[model samples]
Target chain A: MEYTYTRSVGPVIDRFFSGLADRKIQGIKGSDGKVIVPPTEYDPYTGETLSEFVDVADAGTVTTWAWVTDPRPGQPLQKPFAWALVQLDGADTAMLHAVDAGDESRMSTGMRVKVHWCDEPVADLAAIEYFEPEAS
Target chain B: MRDIAVVATAQSPAIRKEERRNEVEILMPVVHDLRKRAGLKQEDIGFTVSGSCDYLQGQAFAFVTALDAIGPWPPIDESHVEMDGAWALYEAWTRLQYGDIDTALVYSFGKSSPGDIRRILSLQLDPYYLVPLWPDTVAMAALQARALLESDGVTEKDLAEVVSRSRKNAKDNPNAQLSGDVDVDTLLKEPMYLSPLRKHDCPPITDGAAAVILAADDRARELTDRPAWIRGIDHRIEPHSLGVRNLADSPSTRTAGEKAGVGNGNVDVAELHAPFSHQEIILKRALGLGDNVNVNPSGGALASNGVMVAGLQRIIEAADRIMAGQADRAVAHATSGPALQQNLVAVLEGEK
Candidate 1:
């Protein structure tokens, strides 16, 4: 028997993805003033609930990366790609995403990349297709 | 820290297809029987935990529907593992260590016959490299069996012997799905489902649910004069990739067994979760059990392999022996992931 799962996105996450739909990155600022990437509902270090959302720039520097010589099912990339931990321009921590760098030699830590949004945003993680290196 | 014991265990009859009812309906009777036999009410349970795979149910959050059987009107502290019931028991044991909850209920249900069991297991592999080829569970176990045969000089006859013994043992267990007296010679002559493995060598496709109740210290004594005290429990995981580790040897099981003190003294009874015949031999070697250990006195997984639930049933069966004064100390084991990539072992004992 086949089964399907319909997950209900909570309000905090819904707003985060809605922001992504507008090609904008949002982060939740904790009481400590540290901005969290992917906009967590609660502060991990303080254990306090967060409500303040701030827009962060999409352009970011790659912090660390692992090349996905072969991509897996449900991943953002269908072809050879690099999975980079990117610290978005105004965020304090890194978020994982596919890096479309054409080849392995072109991808490196500290390289600057810009978000390449999907043609149509569906309020899902895949709305951001992948990050590609900025044109030299 | 408080001592916890598995007081009661009950399971639905294993079947190829339980079409008349869904998971909740299938589980209600088992839950009722477990509560009834343990002489306890639903309200008496301090915590509940379950083990199941969303993949097996063909739906995510399958356990959510199953919660209906427990009747959550009062609300209970609960958690779930995307693993076998044995791991749920491990979590319950850990909870008991805190002395917060005295009584906990652990259960698991699976409908292995619903879809292609082998095909579904391929998802457990590293999704990127190995899964595209769709290597099923049987083929992977076959690889391990092949390694055992080539390296250790284990013969086909030995595999058949496990099947024969398991079926004979199952004759006494009404809950067993497959059981009968079959000659090892006849089993060896049967056509190979996977080469070097006969039809009986592999577990029959079974759909079933099982539940076990754990009571700690005073509650255990109040529930039964003979409580099967858990002496030790531990589990470990190996890397997901098959190429990264040795197939013939289960290092995870070895590590868990040592931590659980399987060979601390004498183990009168052993219940090892071996879905295939050769896995039993591999587990025996891994646990370092000699000829003295009475292995799978309750027929083990060869008689009824109920996916996520079978492993916990092993622990329950071993505990039953101690509770009934049939044995003093015993070892029970559970395995998960592809080719036994994860393992849990526990030691149970009765009052001296």
Candidate 2:
């Protein structure tokens, strides 16, 4: 069975979706002075409303990762990939995404990766297909 | 806070699949057994509350169907939480403090076999950023496991020992679905299903239900001879996002443990709801439980994890020891959300 429903992303989420469409990554400066990608309207700690928008690099380092040897259906990658929490260059917190390194031996913590933009940009997380190893 | 105690508890045997029984079918026997032990009918109970996820049953208001087991003909005062039964028990405990309701019946059930368990769990993630990626529970857990491994220098052998010990402990628990005498060396030799995680490190996919009864003060003594009085009960949660949170440490569990006064007295036994082997390690550290504490003598969630039921089972296991006169003081811990984002801790003790 399948169903579809549409709802507004609201102000905070709307900004994220619109930014993804233009392939320009951005984060909101949290009350703690840290930038958070896919930002939340209120500070996680203090619950204060946040407004400052900050641009972040499309590249970042892997903070921690899990190697998925067997991919499940509906997952981002068909082949084996590492699910990583990458700390985007300017963002204080990491964002979850898959890294499409060919082999398990190739993936490691602290490795740098750049976002792989989708062929046809869409206003969702799928706009960035997956992260790839950064060119040294 | 008024003194409340767990007077009676019952749990169905955990199994990989209940092909013949529906969710309601799986719950009926357990609820009947619990009420029978408490010697109370639906009408006698002041309130009824349950915890279960509608997503698991694949229908809206799926929990309402399970109410049939409780015989809600007279329309019992009831509530529901889309969480593990442990949280429902927590709510019931709080409601008992109002002094109007002296007794409450709590239950939770789940059948992870009927659906794509992993994919279905992904729906719990943030809709805008995480849900679209479809990260399974195991994969998400592996991220925390990996982080724990790197930060603490824990080896796969250490993880294997936890799995071996959990399964070995299950040998004594009839409700546990998985149990046996196993060697850590043999387990360590097994292939990795997810890098840094062996198959044993993950919990079994289980279908089961559990029911518990809570009574306040005099009513508790009337229901059970040795009531497991709740000395302290509290819960805390971390931010929803996994990115900013420290995967290596469970600050939520720590805070909840502190609030529950786990360190105030000696804990004879501790029941922790850790679905993964490494998570048990994290919980132990968070609770500040020493080697002196007997942890998960019932095999815990690693032996039989029925998504919404396991957490409550932890409380029952701890309370069971107290009622049996095996332990005087004990602690029960429950967790919800991925990577131990939310934690509930309850300290229980027998009559002083």
Candidate 3:
């Protein structure tokens, strides 16, 4: 049977997704003062619950990336694309997302990219449609 | 590590369809029954864990609704695995080893009859290569059965005998949905549903829920005079690709059996979660179970194959054997993924 999922995002996760809805990025501050993208409920290293939220620049450098020649069912990109581990500016850790680079040669670990928000607002990871190579 | 034991278990009656209630409603009574039999309250449970598949529920985070059955008013330390209930029990057992929580509750529920279970199981295959072919679970198992017959001396007659024995055993189990007396010779003569597998060779599509309560050392003694202490528990996963592994033998089960100390001590009984008649024979060989060991005293999955809950029921059935003084020691087995790609084994014993 066909089943549709309505997930209830808790307060912390809701806030992070809401930020994406507004075409912005949010990170929770760890006890060590590092801003973690895809904010965690608790610090993996210290096991401390984080309450502080901070906005980071949407523009960031690509850390490590794998090319998604074909996308899965619910992935951010509908067409052929690349999935990148992008370290948003002002954030300590990188988050995964699709990069809309036309060719694989244009995508590299040190290359720069910018957020490409979806046309409509929705509270999910898909809020940001993908990233594109930044113009020189 | 302290000795943890499964003291009580309860399961809802298997049905072809259950439209009167959703997952939580169906599970509430089963969970209550397990707690009531153990003489315990929700507050006494230190940890709660469950196993389920989102693909079966057709929704992501399907487990969240089922949590309502437990009533997390005070909030409890809990987690879930995208696996069978038997694996959830393994996680609970590991938590008990830390000597922090003395008691835990493990449960699993699935409504397989709501959808085509055979088609839904195909999604567990590798998304890239195998899922495109849309190979159903029954057809894959049939391939394995064909291999078992060719590689080993096992015949179609052996498969029919298993079906006959399981149906006969289920006659005494009220909760079983499929139970009757059918001659093995007649069963063999029946038409094949899938080549090398007759209609009786497969488990029925069933909807049900199951719950089991576990306690550690002193807590176990306080809960029951005869606690089925978990002597050993372990689980392993094999490669998901069908072509890469041998279908005739379950190396993962044999590896798990050795790790769980299945034959380290004497075992008087065994409850195997084999959904197919041939699979029980395969598992028995993999676990090194001798002919003297009593198998499937609770009728096993052939009687009521409730998808996710069937494996956990095996653990519960084995424990019940020890708790009732029917046996001094017992073994429980559970499997998951296509073609039994994952396996769990638990050894339980009466108080020393």
Candidate 4:
């Protein structure tokens, strides 16, 4: 028995995915003027449909994170990694992604990191394999 | 608003795993027990609603089969929420507001033991980004717990304290799945299950069900000498995306608590639906529960969380205390979605 379905990510988010396929990230400016990466069709706060899409740097700083000692199925990087809220550069909002920092000891808040893109462009969040510490 | 009160309630003992009974069977004794206590049969109930998710059993409309407990022979006025029983109770409470219904039967059941609950919960996340990550519930909670630790005054020790108190308080709750005299120091020593959240910080995957009978003014008086009168009830929700919301606080809960008029009177007890230890801290602050308030005297969702059932159980626990004359004013809270994104607050009181 299997239940499989595809969700429509809508027009605004579809563009964000397309950007990811080309190794680019985009943010939508909400009615509140906050640029939200992984853009939504409408503003999360004001419920207004967004029209502007701004390109954002793939690199960002970790606002917060939770280190996973044991990885679950389908998670990025089966080894020990941290699930972090990375507020990418040029975007006011954060994006949730796995940070392949090797161990819990390496993970820290405010750590500068950049996206680790997948070998092949895939028009999905998985197009970025995982985020890693930018310099090291 | 027409006066309505919780006159009677019943719940199965939270079990880690119920190998024998299916969902209907587990709900039978609970619903029947409430009927017996309220002296009302199936047909007498003006409205019937339940809360249960099909994901646990891996079948769509799986809740339809649960009607076996109600005996559909005569047919009944029934509805169900895909979320938790707390929301179903809210629906029944709303129905009573119409002044047409005299009584309602509310119940919820869940059997997390049969499924990979972590994976199932991930399905609730945004399909494109978060779902693909497949972060488990505990990991999500750990994220909030870490943020709370970093930003708020709450410490890891504070989380352990919540866990310790939950175990101690649950001793009085015969229906609770886990209860003991574990101390905070001992819990803090336990290795992290998902860093910042220990095994004790998370709720046990419980298989159980709970039911409550709601009666209007006069009918409520006739059913019980004391009734947990519904003073006010309201629920609110924050953004679904955890990244957008503040992980250290629960604005939805605060808004719901305010709308429910929790501050109108002195609350003696509060049954908060905080499945994770740190969440108790966040909810406590959001609802403005001072040190004097007795929180989760029934050990809350921490003692035994059956997902869909735990929220309604909070209402039952608070109402039961009010009905027992243990407290005059009490607040019962229920939460759903990731990291307390959705919240329901109900203020119940005893007759003056």
**iRMS for all predictions?**
13.9, 0.8, 15.8, 0.9
Clashing pairs in 3: none
TM-scores of the models, in the order given: 0.72, 0.98, 0.72, 0.98
TM-score of chain A of each: 0.90, 0.93, 0.88, 0.92
Q: Kindly list the per-residue Cα lDDT of model 2 for residues B1-352, writing each as its tens digit.
A: 8999999999999989898999999999999999999999889999899999999988999999998767888778999999999999999998999999899999999999989888898899888888888998999899999999999768888788888889999999999999999899999889989988999999999999999999999999999999999999999989888898999899989999998999999999999999989999999999999998999999999999998999999999999999999999999999999888899999999996
lDDT string for model 4 (B68-179, tens) is 6587668788898998899999999999999988999999999999888989999988887788888788888988999999995889999999999999999999999899
Residue A94, candidate 2: alpha-carbon lDDT: 94
Measured with C-alpha atoms, the lDDT of residue B131 in candidate 2 is 88
lDDT of each: 0.82, 0.93, 0.82, 0.91
Clashes of each: 1, 0, 0, 0
lDDT per residue as tens, model 3, B1-352: 7888888889899887898888778888999998899888888899999987777789999998888668777888998988889989988988988987899999999888777788788788754334543556765676567657767699999988888888888887788888889998899889766556777888999889999998998888998899998888888877564433566899989999999899798889999989988899899999999989888876788889988989998998898878989899999999998768889999998976
1 or 3, greater by lDDT: 1
Candidate 3 stretches greater than 4 Å from native = A1-136
Q: What docking class should model 1 receive?
A: incorrect
Measured against the native two-chain assembly using Cα atoms, what DockQ does each of the candidate structures obtain, in the order listed? 0.02, 0.81, 0.02, 0.79
DockQ preference between candidates 1 and 2, better one: 2
Say which candidate scores most in DockQ.
2
